[model samples]
Target: MPQIKSLDELRNLRQQVERDISTRRHTGTTIIVGMGTCGIAAGARDTMHAILEELRKREIDANVTTVGCIGMCAKEPLVDVEQAGQPRVTYGNVTPDMVPRMIEEHLVKGQVVEEWVVGRLQSS
Candidate 1:
């Protein structure tokens, strides 16, 4: 391994790591869980864990992320989902119980669960 003793060398290593991560970034599907204080208090971490466990059990390829709040603490545990060529959909008041249904409707069937969606958007 190349020596990384200097601060400049460390910066270069950091840049290289960032570049590698950017190259491997997921292009098809994603689920972003808001992880702000309110979200965590409302059990977003549990919701996120449930979602990830389901993905693992089902052997699905989905990129999950913890994101900053979208200024809707009233709707804590918000989740945003996006797929290739699909409009990004946001869900509010997420809970562990909702993860399975989300995976079924959004990931598998390509249909949004309007009841859980943040707004009155079509299920397509």
Candidate 2:
């Protein structure tokens, strides 16, 4: 760390942080939906759409992405949310109707919707 020479430097650093937050909002998050063959057949596409719509409705910007199975093909239509320093929470067998509720209960409220999470078949 450099020595604090003048108040201007501190002000500049704070300004930079504020800018980063705004940028962060635009780059909000990485929301991954499993679209593996089984997942797609099960309805992951709809789940992805629902998630995007919910985020839009809530005015929360996020970078939504899709990927092949996490090897839990039985739990199709799985959704994962990863925020720095927080454990990844994965929702399985999700439906369009459940998106809003999931957002409210999980993303916004900081609560995991256990009923929707895949069975704890694996340890972190």
**Best lDDT goes to which candidate?**
1
Off by over 4 Å in 1: 1-27, 120-124
TM-score of each: 0.74, 0.72
- What does candidate 2's lDDT look like per residue over 1-124, in tens digits? 9776987888889987787687786535668899989999999999999999999999976779999977888878888877655677788878889999988887788787888876432324
Name the regions of candidate 2 deviating beyond 4 angstroms.
Answer: 1-27, 119-124
The per-residue C-alpha lDDT of model 2 at residue 111 equals 84
TM accuracy, model 1:
0.74
lDDT of each: 0.85, 0.81
